[model samples]
Target chain A: MNLIEILSYGFIQRALLAGTLIAVLCSVLGVFLVLRRLSLIGDGLAHVTFGSTAIALALQLYSAASLLVSLPVVLLASLGILKLTEKARLNGDAAIGIVSAVGISIGIMLASVGGGYNVDLLSYLFGNILSISYEEVIIAAGLFCVVMVLLWLFFHDLLAISFNEELARVSGVRTNLISAVLVMLTALSVVLAMKLVGIMLISSLLILPAVSALQLARSFRACIVLAALQGGCSVVAGIFVSFLTNLPTSAMIVMINLLFFCCSCGVRRLITIRNIG
Target chain B: MPVEIVATERLACGYREGYVLEDISFTVNAGDYVGIVGPNGSGKSTLVQALLGLVPISSGSARLFGSRCDNFSQWGRIGYLPQSLHLLNPIFPATVAETVALGLLSLKRFPRRLTRQDRETVETTLDVLGVYDIRSKLIGELSGGQQQRVLLARALVNDPELLILDEPTAALDPETRERFYHMIADVNRSRGVTVLLVTHDTGVIGQHASKMLYLDKRMLFYGGFDDFCHSPEMSSLFGEHSQHLMCHRH
Candidate 1:
């Protein structure tokens, strides 16, 4: 089939729909991750998921049923690390590094012990956008709805906690609950969106969109909205461009986000200078 | 009155260790202007934090409006403008309007998010501080003096009965600091808001504060400004060289 015909196929259409949903969700979360300076938490949790999938595969598991059974386990592990970081008052970058290294090592051990070299493992590591299935797409969509609803209901609380935790606590916000939920939301988002851009590039989609939105976004609410829009456009456009040139979708999406980040950085510098002048 | 506004007895205040300032007792009337002055490391800030429930009381009791300081849920009734209003990054995207609205987080008991009344109060406070023109401006873009005004407005937006300003004028130039002192006087006199101001500027306090609490590792004196300046303790605290700046208070 010709390139245009391939792109217009029903499977391609479904893939785009799913990718867009993932983009929307990741982008919304990316702003907070960047704002909270928890970009590495998302990256760390993605590594944790790798260990989870490795465990699932070593036991001969395939697909959603296995992911369902193991996701909680994976989430709990991330939560443990998050709690540890808070309790021990560790530097956030250090904590993410320790967790990432340990989890990836454990996953490598698991994969080697399984007596098989699976190419599917590599696919999940870096994403196989065209190879995304309908079931995972549905799961991603469901998760997107839940995350969005939670964000909506707790918008004020999230805003309070994100800006200043001590102030939020003094103002009677349940900062611990809200914070845990925020981290979990990041965990869930990384899982769903990692399928499109892989773990390494997922934060790019999340952080870049939010950074760009920061140029114009006044409030936390505006930041999230702008992030989602920037992410959605990047995904759709990236997918189209990648399709035309037969480039990797992950690389294309990340490149697009990087471009936006550079532009916003320049704009922010200009605005700051103008204000100073 | 029906409920005591603030009551503390033998209050020993500190962050987490033993104590910074020990054996303190005081009660403030609803509309009194109390200024705390001390040399560096005198536990002045720690004592204020204890009163604000941000620090642990190593011993004795601290209460706000008849409840323990920790349980004082009426956040709107007590406002605090910390020493460094610029503690937050300038790159942060909060505008003057939005920063002030944070004070409304305690206003969940009120019907609306931010009523027209709240907005007017904010504007009036900013105007009273003489920085109403910068209402739409990003807080990061403000001068140090302007930023303090914004922080002061945020503190007052909830219409608290008791305003606690910790060196609110510390970073301002002398003229700006003079203006802030005037604003504090206006808020206390016209609005009948009780004000507790903490500063190292003893001269300013002697001139303006109705009540002055002096400290050097401990409170050397606590009473009307007239009594504070005349005392030998005040003389000792200021030392012999500061003789001219501090005179017998009337």
Candidate 2:
């Protein structure tokens, strides 16, 4: 079908609207997470959502109602990750690993014991973005506004803490509160985004765009802007490409992000060579 | 009488394992340049961290500007440069000017937006530190000395009343280190800013500091430079020859 033909479908329209909003949210948050060395947090929280989704399905709550079960679980799991890093003196990766391992295992055990829910669970594992509902679109838009507004309100404070937590604290930025806000927002994003990108590939959405921006951007503000642009563009392009090629929409989005990252690296190298010669 | 900027009375602080600093008592008045000298792992950093409320105090009391250390909210009066410059990520995308502007954040309330006047303040501080030309350069791209100066400019941008530097010159070359010391001494002398500098370079810091606080987990010595030079206890602690080398250089 032609481009106009593809846009006519309601499912395609919902997918584009929801996917763009969530992609922007993940990409913007990814900049801070990458700088703070907590990039895996997206993946970790995605796994927690997996376990929580299993519980939700076992209870016969599907689609948007699953959020009623998954939201608080994933939020607490994010706080648990933070507490482990703080009190247990574990590095961020180790803390994430422990939480991620427990989450996936709990999901596996639930899927086995609960029985007859494997088909529904598989969709969450790999995602089906082209089938997004209108309610999920509104949910995505609401989450985008909440994350972006809080991010804008606390922009300088977030920048300060991401640069150096102790320095931020000394500057009276309330580092602990800012850090909690960041992770909790990520948890919210993860719960909302699992439907868009799936649990297995969610981290790529959170990491790839931000790393690409870091390669080419000169200032922090530029980095954030570049990441958001790449994220939103990738989702729209991936949706159109998936329609034309009959490929999976979620995986296509991730591949486009990787392509953008490679192009950014190439451009950065060319700039360095030009500066040198 | 001069106003007290910092005071610790029998202050004790430590981690989960054990106390690193105990029975530490001192009072720093306005414009006093106190050099905190000690051996490696002598809790020099801990003592300062305790006073700044970065670490919890186990017992006793520490105060800044007459308020309890933990409860002190007037961070605009204090500027601190931590010892771990190596902790800064090499790819951090902040410009020197942006980094210096962070120093003004303590004085701002929530939704802290940098005003045009804040930009001017950052510019003046950068010029004072001789880093104005590189204000637009990325912080990680600067050389070690330039990075140190940029961080120092960040510390001084707000024009704080009390400046606390923990081993600020640990990464500079001998010539660069000498220039940095002179720069800090100038800040103390010209601006009348109280300084609490932590360093292991006992000999070099003695020349600039008005008083010496020699610590080895506990207070080994605290007095005027002249008193520190002649004290029998310090002589015993450092040995006569070593004490003379540290004190006579002034």
Quantify all predictions' global Cα lDDT against the true fold: 0.76, 0.92
True contacts kept of 2: 0.63
TM-score of chain A considered alone, across all candidate predictions: 0.91, 0.98
Relative to the unseen true structure, what is the C-alpha lDDT of residue B139 in candidate 1, on a scale of 0 to 100?
73
Model 1 pairs whose backbones collide: A30-A206
Residue runs of model 2 more than 4 Å from their true location after superposition: B248-250
Per-prediction DockQ: 0.34, 0.75
Residue B51 displacement (Å), model 1: 3.0
- What 10-residue stretch in candidate 2 chain A is worst by lDDT? A131-140
TM-score per model (chain B): 0.88, 0.97
Give the share of true interchain contacts found in each model.
0.20, 0.63
**Candidate 1 residue-wise lDDT, B23-125, digit = tens:** 7877788888889987789888787778777767778898887889876787768777886553555556666877777776776642225567877777777
Model 1 chain A: weakest 10-residue lDDT segment is A163-172
DockQ of model 2, rounded to 2 decimals: 0.75
Task: Summarize candidate 1's per-residue lDDT along A141-226 as a digit string, tens digits.
Answer: 88889998888766666766666665555555666778787887877877777678986677677778877887776655566777
Where does candidate 1 stray beyond 4 Å? A1-7, A216-221, A268-277, B1-3, B14-18, B109-131, B233-250
